[model samples]
Target chain A: QQPVQSPQAVILREGEDAVINCSSSKALYSVHWYRQKHGEAPVFLMILLKGGEQKGHEKISASFNEKKQQSSLYLTASQLSYSGTYFCGTGFKAAGNKLTFGGGTRVLVKP
Target chain B: EAGVAQSPRYKIIEKRQSVAFWCNPISGHATLYWYQQILGQGPKLLIQFQNNGVVDDSQLPKDRFSAERLKGVDSTLKIQPAKLEDSAVYLCASSLVFQGLNEKLFFGSGTQLSVL
Candidate 1:
């Protein structure tokens, strides 16, 4: 099943912070985060596996809560380059390598 | 290393027509995936191929869409008798392995299809 993403869209100014949430109805083995600019391919940001793992890149961080079947992405000191659509792909252990993605959250960062 | 390559960046066809998109994955990648992204949405996996065999295609609309990754390097997705709803961007992605742990997917620019 497709996961649900919150805050369908967000507008932020430079140096602001924002959080995007992804929740799945089924148990997730891992949650992968990606960012896609307009007319471009999705770029991998980070992956949070089960066992309450947390991962970060620069000012962007993500946390996965296995018990809650949800993942949250944190973007701090947002920049104009951060403007794009954020997607979270959820994987289930029983589903092997198949991953389902959420609806995505569009972020627009302005000066 | 070269990224995934997809052909015909944009395509426009009338409803009931057939269209096909091609993709070449990064060298040595064993897994290839085809996804559909409608406007204002995330990429939805349509099918996945492990080597030359299909590992998952549960979400593919078999009646209208079919894909094959012959020889495990190049893949093609075809949509026949397309409907207006089929108008979306078809994206091709590849990964070194299919494992969920620490796996990152490399994607192509995707082919935007507009069914009129």
Candidate 2:
């Protein structure tokens, strides 16, 4: 099943902080985060596997909560370059563990 | 290493017509995927291939959608009798491993399909 993401869109200023959440009804083996600029392909940011595993890329970090079947992405000191649509792909981890992406959260970072 | 490559950045077709999208995955990558992303939505996996063999296609509409990855290097997704709802961006992605769920995915620019 597709995971559910909160706060469909968010606006932030330079040096500001924001959080995006992704939740799944079933247990997830991993959660991958990606950012896509307008008219561009999505770029891989980080992936959180299992509970307590934290992944970071510069000022962006993500944590996986296995018990809650949720993942959270944190953006610190947002920059204009951070403006993009963020997507969370949840993996159920069967034999192959195919990733199923959730509806994205749009982030607009301004000066 | 080069990322996934897709052709015909954009396509426009009338309803009931047919369209195809091509993808060239990163060399040596055994896992390839095709996704459909509607405006304002996330990329939805349409099919997956493990070295030219079918793995999963639960989300693909078998009646009108078909995909193949011959020689395990490139893939093609075709839609026949396309409907208005079929308009979306077709994205191609590849990974280094077939069972590594957390591995990074490399995506292509995607083909924008517009059905009138």
Candidate 3:
């Protein structure tokens, strides 16, 4: 099943901070995040694995709560380049790494 | 490393027509995925392949959609008798391995399909 994302849309000024949350009903083994601009492909952002292993862009950070089956992406001091749609893909062990994505959170960062 | 490649950046067809899109994954990548993204939603996984073999295709609309990755290199997704609701972006992504879901994926620009 697809995960759920909070805040369908958010507008922020440069240097602002925001948080996007993704929650899944089933237990997840990992969570992947991606950012996509208009007319472009979704770029890999970060991946949060069970047992606290995280990897991705150096500037971006995220947290995964294994017990809750939730993950959150933190955009701190947001840059104009951060303007895009963010998606979280949840991977379930039962599905053997198959990822189901959330509805996406749109972020608009203004100068 | 080169990124995943997809063909026909944009395609338009009438309802009930047929359309096909192609994808070339990065060199040596064994895992390939096809996703469908509606305008305001996230990309949904339609199928997944590991070295030319299907790993998952539970979400694919088998009645009208089909895909194949020949020789573990390139793949093609075909839609026969398309429906108006099939208008969306078809994204192709690849990962270096299929061991775990934590692997990062590189995506192609995607083929935008507009079914009238």
Candidate 4:
């Protein structure tokens, strides 16, 4: 099943912060975060496993909570380059490599 | 290293027509996947292949959709008798492993199909 994403769209000025959430009904093994710019392929940002360890790339970070079956991506001091659609792909035991993605959360960072 | 390669960035076809999309994954990548992304939505896995063998195709529409990866390198996805709903972006991605904390997907720009 596809995960649910909160705040379908968000607008922010440069230097602001934002949080995007991804919630799944099934227990997850891992959560992968990706960002896709207009007319481009989705690019990997970071991944968080069930153990609760958080990973960060530049000013972006993510956390996975196995107990809650949810993950959250955080953007600090957003830059214009951060404007894109952010998607979270979840992996479960039964799904194997078939990662089901959530409806993306569109983030628009203004100058 | 090249990320991934896809052919015919854009296509327009009528319903009941047949279309095929090609993909070339990164060299030495062991896993390859095809995802369909509709407008205003996330990418959905259509099929996956590991070294020329299918790993998962549970969501694939077997009646009219088919894919193959020969020699564990390049792959192709074909759709016959296309429907209006089939108009979407076909994305190709590859990874080193199926499971792991560090597993990352490298994607191609994808082919946009418009079925009339």
Candidate 2 contains a number of clashing pairs equal to: 0
Chain A TM-score of each candidate structure, as shown: 0.96, 0.95, 0.94, 0.96
- Per model, the share of native interface contacts recovered reads 0.61, 0.84, 0.88, 0.65
Clashing pairs in 4: none
Look at candidate 2 and give me any clashing residue pairs.
none
The whole-model lDDT of each prediction reads: 0.92, 0.92, 0.92, 0.92
List the RMSD of every prediction in angstroms: 1.1, 1.1, 1.3, 1.2
Winner on DockQ (3 vs 4)? 3
Badly placed stretches (over 4 Å) of model 2 are: none
DockQ of each: 0.72, 0.84, 0.83, 0.69
Candidate 2's residue-wise lDDT over A1-111, tens digit each? 899998899999999999999999998888999999988899999988885468899999998888889999999999899999999999876635888888999999989
Residue B103 CA error for candidate 3 (Å)?
0.5
Model 1 lDDT per residue over A1-111, tens place: 889999999999999999999999998888999999999999999988888558998899999887788999999999999999999999887777678889999999999
Q: What DockQ would you assign to candidate 3?
A: 0.83
Name the fnat for model 1. Answer: 0.61
- Interface C-alpha root-mean-square deviation of candidate 2: 0.9
lDDT of 3 by residue, A15-82 (tens): 99999999999887889999999999999898888897655465568999888889989898899999
| Cα error of candidate 3 at position A90, Å | 0.6
Instruction: Give the worst 10-residue stretch by lDDT in candidate 4 chain A.
Output: A91-100
